[model samples]
Target: MTSALILENLCKSFGSGADAVQVLDHVALDLPQGQSLALTGDSGSGKSTLLHICAGLEPFDRGKVVLAGHDITQNDDAAGAALRRDTIGLVFQQFNLIPSLTVAANLAFQARLAGRHDPDFTTELARRLGIAQLMSRYPEQLSGGQQQRVAIGRCLAARPRLVLADEPTGNLDEATGDAVLDLMMELAAQAGTALLLVTHSTRLAQRCDSRVHLRAGKLQVPA
Candidate 1:
């Protein structure tokens, strides 16, 4: 299977020289299309940093990052932005929905940005995510779970080759989080989009196709 994301000998740090703090060290990962991998680590372990680098939102000190066949390292700012818009989807714990837009518009936001907007597909996603009835509602008008379902629908509506989610279920109750994850994974599978998820929940991690724990900026099998 082709890989949607690839990282090789990745390294990142803050500051410089003796004052520098290494957040990621020789970190490497590969996520194939249509599969899911969970990333687990303690706070400040650089899991989110890794996801940002893969999305071309952040730069690595030394490494190669390829997203859906494009080597992002070689892309300039505008090129990287375009590549990210076209090939990557992002979901965050905060449910970054545009408050000004209704649920229907929010769901179609990313897709429209990528020029992949399909009215039929967007409507299908809204129905599948159980947010069809909430489309006319604004983000603030919906509950946490409802907003998150809209967020997920927005991410997948772009038909991105990969989805990089950082602690995507952190704000919801356990049951709600689980249900949200179930919908996320199901939707990802249906769209054939690879998923790389960051979470601290062992139960949630186990639900993915594979799990890797980040320790001291390196990945290892979960103990």
Candidate 2:
């Protein structure tokens, strides 16, 4: 199967010289299309940094990053933005929904930005996420779980080739988080989007097709 995301010899650090802190060291990974992979590590383990690099939201000191078959290691700001607009979906733990927009509008925002707005698909996603009736509600009016459902709906609305999620369910209780994750994985599979999820839950990580652990700024065998 073709890979949707690849990282080779990736290196990243903060600051410079003596005060510099290495975050990623020669990290390598290959995530095949239409599959899911869980990335697990302790706090400060660089898991979120890795996801950001993959999404072109951050830069690495040295390495190669390819998303949906396009090399992004040397991409300029505009190029990186274009790559994200065209091929990547991001879901954050904070449920980054636009407070000014109603749930329906928020759900279609990313798709509209990507020029892939599909009313039929958006409606179906809302129905499946159990947020169809909340379409007219604003982000601030929804509960944490509801807001997250909208966030997931918005990300997948763009039909992106790859989805990067950073602790998407961290705000919810265990049962709610599990349910949200189940919905996310199910929808991602239906869309055939490659998913790289950064999470701390062992049970959640085990639900994915494969798992990778990060330690000491390098990829380690999954524990």
Candidate 3:
């Protein structure tokens, strides 16, 4: 089967010379379509860096990153941005919703940007995420969990082939987090989107189809 995301011998560094920080060192991973994998690691363990690279939000110093048959690792800014807008969805821990936009509008933002807006699908996602009632409100008016639901809805609105989530539930309470994650997983499965989620919760990691741990800037399958 073709991989939805493939990273081969990935390496990334920040800054220069003595001040440079190496976040990923020859890391490699492959995630097939419709599968979900949890990436777990301590703070600054390169988990978020890996997600950024895979999502085309950041560039890797070396190695290849292929998403849905497109080699995005070496693309120029415009090309990479286009690929990301068309093929990748990202959910961050900060719930990066536009503060001024209404919930419904925020959910539809990316889809509209990608020229793939589908009101019907956005409505369904809102309903499934239990955020239909909050659609008229702005991000500040909603609770953390509600904001997260909106974020997830926004990512799913485009029905992109790959979803990259970074600490998606880190700010929510246990019950709310579990409920939101359940909905996310269900929707991701239904959409057949490959999910790469960076998380710290072992229970959450165990619930995914596979789990990978980042240590010393390399990925290892958990035993």
Best by TM-score: 2
CA RMSD, predictions in order: 1.6, 1.4, 1.5
Q: How do the predictions measure up, each by TM-score? A: 0.93, 0.94, 0.94
lDDT (10s digit) by residue, model 3, range 21-139 = 88899988889999999999989898888888888887779999999999885588898888989999999887889998999999999999999899999998898778899989999
Candidate 2, which segments miss by more than 4 Å at Cα?
none
TM-score of 3: 0.94
CA displacement after TM-score superposition, residue 218 of candidate 2 (Å):
0.7
lDDT of each: 0.89, 0.90, 0.89
Candidate structures ordered by TM-score, highest first: 2, 3, 1
Mind giving the per-residue lDDT tens digits that candidate 1 earns over 80-144? 98998998999877788999999999999999999999999899888877789998999999988
Candidate 1: minimum summed lDDT over ten consecutive residues — where? Answer: 171-180
Winning model by lDDT: 2
Candidate 3 overall Cα lDDT vs. reference?
0.89
lDDT of 2 by residue, 1-223 (tens): 9999999999999999999999999999999998999999999888988988888878789989989889997688898899999899999776879889999999999999999999999999898778999999999999888898899889988999999999888877888788778878887798888999999989899999999999999888675
| Weakest lDDT window of 10 consecutive positions for candidate 3 | 51-60
Clashes of each: 0, 0, 0
